[model samples]
Target: MARVLYLGGLGRSGTTLVERLLGELPSVCALGEVVHLWQRDILDDERCGCGARFSACTFWKRVGEQAFNGWGNVDVLRVHALRDLVERTRHIPRLAAGHMPMDEVREYAGFYAKVYNAAAEVSGADVVVDSSKHSALAHVLRWASDVDLRVVHVVRDARGVAYSWTKTVTRPETDGAEEMTRYSPGRSALLWNAHNAAFGLLGRRGVAVRRVRYEEFLTDPRAALIRLADFAGLTLVPDDLNFLRPDHADLGVGHSAAGNPMRFTVGRLPLRRDDAWVAKLPPRQRRMVSAMCGPMLRAYGYPVFTEEA
Candidate 1:
């Protein structure tokens, strides 16, 4: 079986950073967001973490060959259609309840299994990290018996997540000036609650799941990395974590298929909590986000009422 560490969470919850750090492990291959592989990589030919276009990246080229003969052999449209059919927030209930159409779920998850298995084979890694961060896809993977799936549920303060969606970040993976999709504070808050709740259901279903909060992870990344490594069934000696420091990490070039522009970052990257929302987010929006994410915010140890609010 192909060991997979599936990072599940809402966007801007710091999954990309977690994925990047884990990718540095000797036996792990981090594939940014395979859910976007068909559209963003295969069709758009976006930039990979290695700074090469997906079509030109030797690693992915080999992955394509290993997974399906070659990228040319993939039916991007068919995969996209399958994704649309089963991978959505609305389908999470059925997927979690195990009431899903097994045939469709298996078909969708088979593509992922192929990619993950191929990634592991091509990278010579024992485990593959997929920071797709979608609860739906993680649930759908349950039908893929070939994949040994482990879930890392990354969570951030709902307020911070809401604030992140309010900002305009450019997508550097494309040639043209394109911006990442933005969502309202309310929408982000609701999503934070829903996505986290959905992943929680995985734990109930007996899937191996670990929840890592962004705040705690950044505060003591060394310890966090060690725990994460152990969860993914890898060992990390002290020397293996030499790349990490108290305040930054020494990152190397990765070949993630899709994710935050930070996926393309290399060298020394600072590690700091993004608390801009505590002060910059309008007071009214902060209150609304807190109210909307009330139970989950508390569930994740975030204060429902803050001094800033």
Candidate 2:
């Protein structure tokens, strides 16, 4: 069995950064957003984190070979159909309650397990980090018999998340014309609440869950990494994270399949809090997002009434 540290949360909440940092650890292999592996990597053949097309990345080629004999052996359509059936926000309740068809859920999770297991074997990593950021997929993985799943539920302020979604960032993993998805502030706010709340269910369902606030992580990345490493059952010494400095980290290219364009970043990357939302997000929209996510905002230790123009 493979141990998986699943980064579960809403999009734009810093899972990619966390996953990238975790990949710096010798015992961890970061697989970016395996939920999109079929569509983005296998079918579309987008760029991998290693700066090669997915089809050309030797690491993923080996992963495919180890996991399913080869990528060609995978029935991408069948996997996508299974994902659509069981991995959705609507299915989270049934998944948490174990009310969904167990057979179908297990079948879907089996594919993920195979990937994680193969990744661990090929990379010789003790734990594979899947920064999927999908609460629904986290819930679905509860049915994977061979997966030892632990959840790191990353969260950001609702206002920050809403602002991030409104920006037009390019998806560098694809053609220049394809930009990342954007969402209205309201939709981002509601989803921020829903996704974080869904992850809360995992702890109750007996999954090992750790909550990492994006703000706190940026403020003290060393302490954050220490906590995460401990949660993932690894003992970290100072040298294991010497690459992390007070304001930046020395990063190397990885083989993450799909994530924010930040996954493509390497070299000495500065680590700072992105509070541009405070200065740029409209007053009306900020207040609206705060109000929409009031309970969850406070639950996650964010000040709901602190937003200003």
> Root-mean-square deviation of each candidate, in angstroms?
0.9, 0.8
Q: Candidate 2: how many backbone clashes?
A: 0
How much lDDT does candidate 1 score? 0.93
TM-scores of all predicted structures: 0.98, 0.99
- List, residue by residue over 1-309, the lDDT tens digit for candidate 1: 899999999999999999999988889999999999999999989999999999999999999999999999999888888889999899988998878788989999999999999999999999999999999999999889899999999999999999999999989998647999999998988888889999999899989999999999999999999999999888878898999988899999999999998999999989999999989999899999989998888888889988874
Q: Residue by residue across 133-162, what tens digits does model 2's lDDT show?
A: 889899999889899999999999889999
Worst 10 residues of 2 by lDDT: 300-309
Off by over 4 Å in 2: none
Q: Candidate 2 at 129: error in angstroms?
A: 0.4
* Residue pairs with clashing backbones, model 2: none
